[model samples]
Every structure is written in structure tokens, then in C-alpha cells.
Target: MTGKTVGVLGFPFSKGQPKGGTELAPKELRAAGIVDRIQALGNNVIDHGDVDLSGLPADSKVGVAKNSLAVGEANKKLSEDVAKYLKKGEQVLLLGGDHSLGIGSLHGHTQVQPDTVVVWVDAHADLNTPFTSDSKNMHGMPLAYVVKEMAQFLPKTPGLEWCKPSLSTKDIVYIGLRDVDPGERKFIEQLGISCFSMHEVDKFAIKDVVEKALSQVDPSGNRPIHVSFDVDAMDPIHAASTGTKVPGGLTLREAFYIAEEIAATGRLSVLDMVEVNPKLGSPEEKEVTVANTVSVTAKFYGSKRQGDVPPNYVIPRPQA
Candidate 1:
């Protein structure tokens, strides 16, 4: 138990990409006992319920970006909600409909904590711009919309006008990257963002990768941390229910190690756990995915693999 109050918000939205059933993640995760599990860890848990994603504008394709209006509208609401909870002094945990929710989560977090540093744990960079992306999925372009350095490259996206670029390219570090777009690769090189792809993860190990990522992003070690974790960061075996499946990803231990290390920082202010689509896999696969996700999430809030002790306890004297 970190003695922190965690505010949980669910985004039952899937318009960021061309997928259904992602909208059901919040309900599914709750059914799996996400709130209760965190409560057992000794923190005050408040389930804020799912964000209302109704009555969005009937948006058409804006250039290459699909569902621009709906994505933007939903995220605007998400941004406001996230900022509200953070202002109340509770650490926020955002459960997603897709990675697109990152736009609002990051936007809202930076609004309250301007000096926040981001550790993006995903197999894909999610850094593509509309012009650069072939699929035109908003989920793949969340970072592009919010990163200040990429602002010049972005066109005037219609529904996203309310979102201002709040994060600098240097304020973010990437881990578990295995599949990256060519344009995204160019962006990373040109912008000089620190990236530790699976290659580095294999070479340096998860522990070193996490340490180096944190050090590179926040050398002073005092900045508030936002971990935007996509379940697809793990190998398909661990998280097979996501829309995007990139093989040869992080192992379960590696995933837990990252969460544990981040939890140890004590500066984790917001965590976005995204891309668990319940509609994508077999029944058994979905169960495994949800269970693994819940387990990993618990680690971020002080649940130890070695088992946790209650905050205070005493040794019982024999027959006292």
C-alpha cells in the first residue's frame, strides 16, 4: 500500500480505431474485480465509472485521420475529467477503450502537473501523424497530437482544436517498442526522443532498461511520472486480446518489473492502462489477458510479488 488514493476512470470508447467491443473494456475490467483488487492493496480506491461517450458528432474522415470529431470530442471530455480527479489529490488510473485515450489522459495530466514525464510502454510507438499513417487510426497518433515538437508537422485537425500540445519531445521516454512506422522512426531520430525498444530490452535487461529510461527522462528524479502502458507491450501470449498484436514483446516478468519499478518511484501521478479489447480473442484468451492486466496493475500500486504485509501488525505472544 502506497497510502495513496487512486481514482479510477474508464473510457468505454473505441472510435479511435476501427474496432468494436473495445468499448466494453471498462465493464469487463470492473467485473474482473479491478476496484476490489486495488482496495485490498490498502489504498483508498474510488471507481469514477465510465466516461459517457454518447452524442458525439457524426464525424467523417478528415483527410487521413478517421473519426477525428468523435475521437476529439470524447478526449476533450476525458481531459476534463482526469484534471478534475487529479486536482482532488488522487492518483489517476485510466482504463481505456484504445490507445487513443492517451491524448486526453496526457493532456489532462499535463494540465495539472506541467512538469510530468511520460514513460510510454507499448510495442508500437503510437507517434504517427495523420499524413504519415496509412491506417488513419487516432490510436496510432495520440502522441503526435500532444507533443509540442510535433505540432509543426500536424495539420489543423478539426475536433482536436481544443487540445494544446503540452509535452516536449524530451519529456518522454519509450520502452518495449518492437513495431514502429517509418515516419515515426524519422520523428524519433529528428526529435531525439529516448527510446529503448525490445532490442535494448533484450540486451540490457528490464531492470536496466527501466532505470535508464527514468534517468534519461527525469535526470533530477523529482518530476511527476505518467506511465502510459498499452497491454500490447507484452508478448501476445500475455496480452492477446488487443487490436494490435506485435509478437516478440515483453515477457510477463518484464512487464511486472516495469510496473514495480515505476511504483517504487513514488512520483507516479497518473497511469493509463490501454488497449485491452475483449472482443478480439477467444474466451480463454480474454480471461488470461484481463487477469494478467489486473495483476500487473496491482503491482503499480505497491502490491509486491514477494507478497505484501499489512501496513501495521504485531507478533502474537503465545497464549498471552
Candidate 2:
């Protein structure tokens, strides 16, 4: 088990999607005993109650980007919260409201670890800017705002001024991407971001894909890793509760292995498990999704089951 102190920041604020119940994810996950489970893993876990963005009006939408102000304000607050824990040398598990929370979670991570390597595991590239997003969803455009190369092309949204482009295209890697908009594709190709799509996963298998991904992002294997995992990255069978369901995606085993491998590196300092929407599925589906998400988080803290034998243990065989 990791010896690091873990700060669990539950961000139940979800204005990123055009739906409800996603904001309730933090509560549901907590109810499922995330804090207790992490504590059981021999790590010091602090539950920093769900972020308070209630003061921000829900009906507020600004410019071409729907809910731009609300999303921006919430992210700004979240950035401050995350930065606090990082400044104190504590690892963070940000139970996300939506994938849009990436704007804040990743930004806050960079405050302390400027050279952090982001492993963005999701179905969509999320590289759309306000000008390019046909749906005007802030979640789809988060990476565009944070990437320095695309900043000039994006218009200034209400709460985005506090956010500067902190991630160069090379500082991040994308995995489990099966869906991409035309604009997002063009931007990704032009910038030459390292992406391991579902096609690559099928061709090279997850292990090799992860190896190549890590090599691209952290060639020296020294920078801290921040894994922003969207539940939609999994196939609909495993994670049907998420809003965006791509047919072919990572299996439960593949997802867990990715998390475990990163944890083993001893450089996983931040995590964002986002986009598990309870309202989108049946009760059983919700349970499975939440359980799977929790399971992945467990792996992030070094839960390797039978393989995690006590290092100092010697078989106390009977004197035969």
C-alpha cells in the first residue's frame, strides 16, 4: 500500500453536462464507502466534503458555451481546493462531478507539480473549443482551454481568465478514445498529441499501449502522474451509467491494470474518476458502475489482490 497521505476531494458540482444526477455521484460513491476503503488500505485518507458550488445559479449559461460561467466558477473553486492538498504534499483523489472538472483538477495539480504528466483516459478527445463545439458543452472544450497552443483561438469565457494554458500537447496522453469530433480530430492531429485509441488497444493490447504511453509522457519516469479517468472510457456493458457510451472500449481488467501499473510507478499523485451518472441507467447498472469505479480507485492505491503479498513474509512451513 502507498504510504502517502490521500486527500479525497468529492466534487459533486455538475453543470458540465446537460443532465442531472451526475452531481450526486460524490454522495453515492461516499455512501459506497470510498473513504473507509482507502483508509483500510493503510493510507491516511481525509474526506474533504463535496465542494460547495451551490451558491452558483444552475440556470446560468453564458455565450456560445452553455453553463460557461457556472462551470468556470466551480472549476476555479475546485482548483484552489486541489492546490491546497498538493501544496501540503498530499495525494488527491478527486471524485468528479463530470469530466469538465478536469479543467480544475488538472490545473490544481500543476500548481504544485508543474511538470505533471496527465494520462487522460476517456472516450472523447475533449479538445473542442467554444468556436468548434456544436453542442456548446463546456466539458467537451476543457482541454482546449488548458492547452496553450489552442488558447488564442478560444474566446474568453466568464470564469476562464484565471485559467492559463498549463499543459503543452506533449505533457498529456489520451487513452480509450473511440469517439472524436471533426474539429477535435483536426486539433489533435495538428498538435500531434499521443493518443492510444480503441484501435490501438486492440492492435497492441493494453499492456503494450500503456508502456508506449508512459514512455511518451514520461520518458525518464520521474514526473508525477495525474490520471483523469472517465467512466465512459469503459464499454457500455461495464459502465452503462455514463452519459456517453462508446460500444467498444476498455474492459474491467484492462482498466484496473492501467490503474495498478500507474500506482506501481509510485508517481500517481492525483486522480479524477468522472462521468458516472446514476440517472442514466437501471439500479443494477448504477451499482456495477460505481463498484467498478471504486475498484479502479482501489487499484490506484496499490490493491493488487493475491499479487500483493507481504514483501517481508517468509512461508512458515511446518518442519517436515
Best by lDDT: 1
Model 2 per-residue lDDT at 264: 84
What digit string (tens of lDDT, one per residue) describes model 1 on residues 9-124? Answer: 99999999887978888889999999888888888999999888889898754555899999999999999999999999999999998999999999999999999999999999
TM-score for each prediction? 0.97, 0.95
**Positional deviation of 217 in candidate 1, in angstroms?**
0.2
Q: Which stretches of candidate 2 lie over 4 Å from their true place?
A: 57-62, 307-320
Q: What's the TM for model 1?
A: 0.97
Q: Pick the candidate with the highest TM-score.
A: 1
State the displacement of the C-alpha of residue 217, model 2, in Å, after optimal TM-score superposition: 0.9
Worst 10 residues of 1 by lDDT: 307-316
Question: Which pairs, if any, clash in model 2?
Answer: none
For residue 216, model 1's alpha carbon misses the true position, in angstroms, by 0.2
